[model samples]
Target: MSSKILTCSVLSALATAFLLDWYHKKFEVTTPPTKNTPRKPRKYDDSLIREQLSRNYSFLGEEGLGKIRNTFVVVVGCGGVGSNCIISLIRSGISHIRIVDFDQVSLSSLNRHAVAQLEDVGTPKVECLKKHILRIAPWVTVETHNELFDINNAQPLLMDGNPDYIVDCIDNIDTKVDLLSFCCERNLKVVSSMGAACKSDPTRINVGDISCTEEDSLARSVRRRLKKRGVLKKIPVVFSSEKPAPGKASLLPLPDEEYEKGKVGELSALQNFRVRILPVLGTMPAMFGLALATYILCDIADYPMEPIVGKSRTKVDGIIQSLAGQQSRLGNTEQRIPIPNNDIIYIVEEIFRGKSPISNYSTRLTLSQWDPAKKLSLQNIVVMTKEEQKLHEQRVLKGGEKLESVYPPEVIQLVEKRFAEEKFYSQFR
Candidate 1:
């Protein structure tokens, strides 16, 4: 009985002590304020950035470095020009970067792309760019938008963080114009690239306002379009004043027996059409990219590059201007020219317009020169399309005639369809 009474007393005492401790913590009173202490700014050491970009410090100083770090740069395409631009920016201590591209690295891209490799084939360009940037400037904060920069996404992609510098290296004209228009409308700083293909002179490349640029086919096209939108001047561009040598204009081989698979890749995103493969000298894009980078960097440092202004009429610019003028005069003029009903005519039209008028095929046609003996035309495709396969089986059931094994099913179907459609449309006419 005595032991039980002692145990109860000890439990009561312990429970009371626990309740007192809980009350003290839960409703504890705080000390009154002693108010006048200033908060210390967090310490930062830029030793790595300082060391890496030490060479630039002599020219730009810490002020330039600060601006570069604070600046958010956006590179639109991750091709030869863009890849180099991103790298130059990163090397110059521009840490905040965003890349926008939708293309996968093709085996052909390695010739000019500074960051692309054999292993990078089939990888998205923006993803590959991020990896490459991280390899060199690991401290950089890179954001990638693995998408095409179109009007729909341009606002979101560019304005999300309010980029400081936008680089235009896109291959497509419409997209380029859209990006440039957006920048111009918002008064954003941007530098664009012109035709770097077929250009070999690194010394001739320069940077200037789009209005002041000369000798570049791309710059001329862009200028004409921007003028239509009332964007007359102040858009910066990197261009080459060197003219492509006289005979070098026709760089692509004739679509003879050899180049039947003409311009295999590279299709237009907007029109869904194939463009001719312009000859690209490997180093030319790199040179243009470096020039573009220099312009942007110098612009950031409050310094301007010594851009070459053309005094005489440039051969390339003169040709482009004449073509533009001719385009206006050719509007709805019924100047009939004799067109031979031959395979070559069809192939030539398709080559220039990016699609065959008869078949409406937007991709590259696997076409060869017509053999007069075989009685074939360029419209006579070699491969069996799905519709042709069905028609071939149906025609075989009629048992009228057996086609030669060498003749493709598509050719037979095309002939029948063309005749049938023509007869129907002609009856109405």
Candidate 2:
């Protein structure tokens, strides 16, 4: 009985101690400040920043490093790519940056977010980035905006600061289009990140114009949308040329249990915000982010790189000359189509992707009219190999055969889609 009474007393004492600690933490304030103490001015260790970036100074030279330190950059979309990019830029000596993102760190984001800790989950991504950035780059100025970047707020967020450069790491198609279009209209220097999802190869990544990027559907869509806005082929981007391994990755399918809840659209962050998530290889996004930072830093230091395009204008001229020859062979004495040289180049690079849609041949490609009855315009032209062009002329142009009769459904569908895109672009012209 004495032992039981001692146990009860000990439990009561422990509970009381726990409550006291909680109370102190929750409500107690520190000792009252002593009066008349002069507060010292806050001092930042600029020497430490220089020591931290000493290697950068050596590599970029003193003048180059100075330029980097003074340049202002705005990064939108603080997700996997954007987070890595922000940290890399800060480490590279960019003293001023504005980070824009409306997302909270989710449990799933732990896989690829550069500086997010488990404790950061449920916090805004921009806030988390700023917190960690100030720890390392205390001398740097970081502006955090925990709101989505859209047309409604683009002017003040992008233009008011006169940022030297803008980095676009957004993943949504519509949002990306809006940002890129705004940059192009305002002549703002910008570099964009293309799709890194489902990509596993680091070597396949390349820095190039949006029109030169291949094997990335996201880049293709962005390029097409930009073209519709009369902004063609100058916006730089980092994209993967590697084709996704077959059956290795895809959009995750919703389970039956999820469907039972009804209206899957409600599950998205916003309307048309991509309900399905693409499976990502975490390292790929990091590589893309680093590439973007490297590209921007070099540019800021006055050492810009000429990113490679898929086909040069000289190559386009050859294709155009070859098409003129084909028109001659078809008894059209004019030898020139109704389309302008610039429009023809756009057709070859942007629409046909610098290859034959029928045989996927990149070499010896020439354009032929899909339908002889239609006037030769952007919508009427199609790319084909030399042999394929000859056969098309014999079978369709002169033989009066329908496109459905000569081409398979897939080819027909592809040609139709290209024509529709050309028609859409015509409105902008």
Candidate 3:
């Protein structure tokens, strides 16, 4: 009886101790402020929150914009076209961009390029443009590559980012071809801008399926090369239909040293009526950039726009004709000129026979001529022909049905040899 009573007494004492410790913690947590202490109220910055909310809500109506914010675009030039494109893309809410360009900001670029400020003259274009993008959209993620796009590095650069779209604003034909071919082979959607120089009219620009002609100077060269490799049919391009202006003869030719050292004022004074830079030339790049952005947005919204076909002139005609002849050509094959091969002798003979004439050339070139230095190869020989000289074009387009092959084995061997020789020279340089 005494033992049981002692156990009960110990249990009571332990329970009381535990309750006292719990009570002390509870008192500390609920303690009221002393009379001398001052209380601080929670604060909210309404203006800052309102600003952020406004930006986010602006896109609430645009499902396309929301989709675009998640996509990545790789632009391969940072000059006039590229800078404008990047800036526009950022402003449109594209948060991811990879820019590649090896050029430095030049004084001449300040006239039209978006990011070419006076202070950025010597800075690399990629770096300067990236800084500008960050300033415009702090949330944007931009990667800069200060290098030329080439076969050796293009694949890795493209694959590294896994870009959803590629914009080609590059001027070099070889580089453009390399990138286009790479993109096509990888099945990546891409858009390209052809020569914007010497073009004045912005309305002439159009994007579309690459025509089947070997007549556009740049397009012809690209088509011929791609044809040889069976890649021509797969590539799509955007190009201008306006012809470049004719060359002018200068009476008082400046010396090379003087030409190189001329200031902006001096250069302006020497400009002849035949040679001038149009403000529209700069605007065309921006126009192309917008087209690229539109393509991206359309793709994300599941409303793909139809590719433009041929040059704008022919394309417009086709549209009108299609509306009229909609039923007659229901299953007809799309009309396209045949790709040409390098064979100067055959081309000349065909032209002399009146089977092919130079009139088939695109509007981009008013005059095309063979350069002995540049056209040593038969393939290049075809490229050097005048706009109206069509011996080669006739055989490829009309006589293709009758002719066995415009590019026989011998012609192919000659072209390969010339290309190898050119490559060898390039390696040493």
Candidate 4:
């Protein structure tokens, strides 16, 4: 009886303890946030926050909006193209930008450069542009490098923030080449601007296959120099080739001329020549800049590559047949085959239209009858003697004549068809 009474007492004690713990939790009084403590403002009720978010969504849709807001773009020149590109990137919702340049704003720069203003004169391009960007997007992270991009400093500047894309707007050819090689070696994607100095026609400006040559003088010179170095053989480039109007000789000495002058004494008398500067408004650079930004964004978003439009190659084939007398007895003697003149044309037609060749060339060749017995039968023979071969080599070496299309016609046709079919998706994908 005593053991049963002890067990009942212990059970009652355990139930009493459980009731005490439950009572503490059920009727507890909690302290509110202290006066000194801070609370995060609700994002939904903030109009500024809502507007920024809406802009991001409107510019870069839901799928890639986050990526764009987080991306870093390094623009390597604050001249015409760089300034325009940076502005477009900011307006497109890109939140991080780095401007690198060693130039100071001058009076002449105000006419063409987007970010150059009267008040910005004498200021470093990088600093001035960063200030402009901050004014537009205060939340954006803007960094500036007031140094020229050279072999020694390029690597660090390029790799510093782990840039997602690099835009080349440098004017010097050697510098541009160095930047391209550096980016290519590091496997970083980059887009470069070609000669935009002397062109005026906006319609003539275009982005296209880098292999094809345009008739513009600046492009030709660039192509020659780049080809000599084997750089333009495969690198994709964005350039315009519209011929500039003839003007007075240039007053501003070439970069090489300046170097030579530095080697010599400044007292040496060198006649200054006056050259015409191309009239560049905001439209062409703006268009190309936006296109470049679109390409970069599309790449980051895992979209299909956009086809660069360029000159198309057109080829024509003709067969010549000799007339025979009706009901006449045929001779068994070796029949003679006549040669038909053939021509190939390389044309820069409108990207939308598929008709008309821009340039044409005709060449004549000797023809021979096909032989079934031979493994490789002769159909049309070009019996170019040694002298002809020597002349052809001479012309090629002298760069007297442009070659026929560098690519096959069928390949170009296939590419054009693919471009047309996938163009819409490429724009926003």
Q: RMSD in angstroms, all models?
A: 21.5, 11.4, 23.2, 21.5
Ranking by TM-score: 2, 1, 4, 3
Runs of candidate 4 exceeding 4 Å displacement = 1-50, 53-56, 216-234, 243-283, 303-305, 313-429
> Model 4, 311-394: lDDT tens per residue?
333222322221111001123243432322221111113222222111121233211111112221122111222333334334
Q: Tell me the spans in candidate 2 whose CA falls farther than 4 Å from its real position.
A: 1-42, 308-429
Best by lDDT: 2
Pick the winner on lDDT between candidates 1 and 3. Answer: 1
TM-score of 3: 0.52
Q: Rate the local accuracy (lDDT) of all candidates.
A: 0.66, 0.84, 0.57, 0.56
Write one digit per residue (lDDT tens) for candidate 1, span 169-240.
Answer: 987777898899988888888889988888887766777777876557778888889899988658778888
Best by TM-score: 2
Give the per-residue Cα lDDT of candidate 1 at 54.
90
Indicate whether candidate 2 or candidate 4 has the larger TM-score: 2
- Per-residue CA lDDT of candidate 3, range 1-429, in tens? 999999999999999999999976653324433421212211325454335435543643356556676788888988777788788877766777888887799887786688678899998898788667755565666777877788899886687758888888886767888888888787888877665655555655666656532223667677666666567545555566543322421124445675577653445422321123433446666676666656555666566578644332222333223222321332225342121222222233222221222333333221112222342232333322232324343454333432235445664454445444434433322
